[model samples]
Target: MNFLVYAGVKLFTLLLLMLAGGLFLKALDRLIFPEVDFAHELREDNEAVAKVVAAAILAWAIALALVLG
Candidate 1:
């Protein structure tokens, strides 16, 4: 019962964190590229933009891992 409760809480927390991260990223996107349409780029399948975004995300992940480690 304790394990079940713990697992449920952990799942909820992770989902919440992911949503918050996405919102934060959106804000960052707007601030960094106010003139850019990230959604449009994604829709048009822009690989260069995608690659840059992916690299930014990976860098963030690495920094997060390092801090959390």
Candidate 2:
């Protein structure tokens, strides 16, 4: 139905927004966490940076969600 299609489109848009936000985070991660190398920490499986990145993404998602609403 139309509602189902609209929901699907919204979900897809959310997915894309998350992806873009993550990339934005990565791009700014260095300036934000200059003490740590984002890509290196990621490859070495560093939990600290992981959490920081997750938080940034969540913050971004929340802001985006608010705007979308």
What do the candidate models score in CA lDDT, each in turn? 0.80, 0.82
Task: List pairs with backbone clashes in candidate 1.
Answer: none
In model 2, which range of ten residues has the least summed lDDT? 24-33
TM-score of 2: 0.65
Steric collisions counted per model: 0, 0
Off-target runs (Cα >4 Å) in candidate 1 are: 56-69
The residue-by-residue lDDT of candidate 2 on 2-57, one tens digit each, is 99999898888888888987777777876777787877987899999789767866
- The whole-model C-alpha lDDT of candidate 1 against the native structure comes to 0.80
lDDT score of residue 66 within candidate 2: 93
Score every model by TM-score: 0.73, 0.65
Per-residue lDDT over 1-69 for candidate 1, one digit per residue giving the tens place of the 0 to 100 score: 999998787677666766777799899989989999888997899999889878977876675556444
Worst 10 residues of 1 by lDDT: 60-69
lDDT, model 2: 0.82
Model 2 error, position 11 (Å): 0.5
User: Which runs in model 2 stand beyond 4 Å of their true positions?
Assistant: 31-34, 38-54
Residue 54 error, candidate 2, Å? 4.7
53 Cα displacement, candidate 2 (Å): 3.9
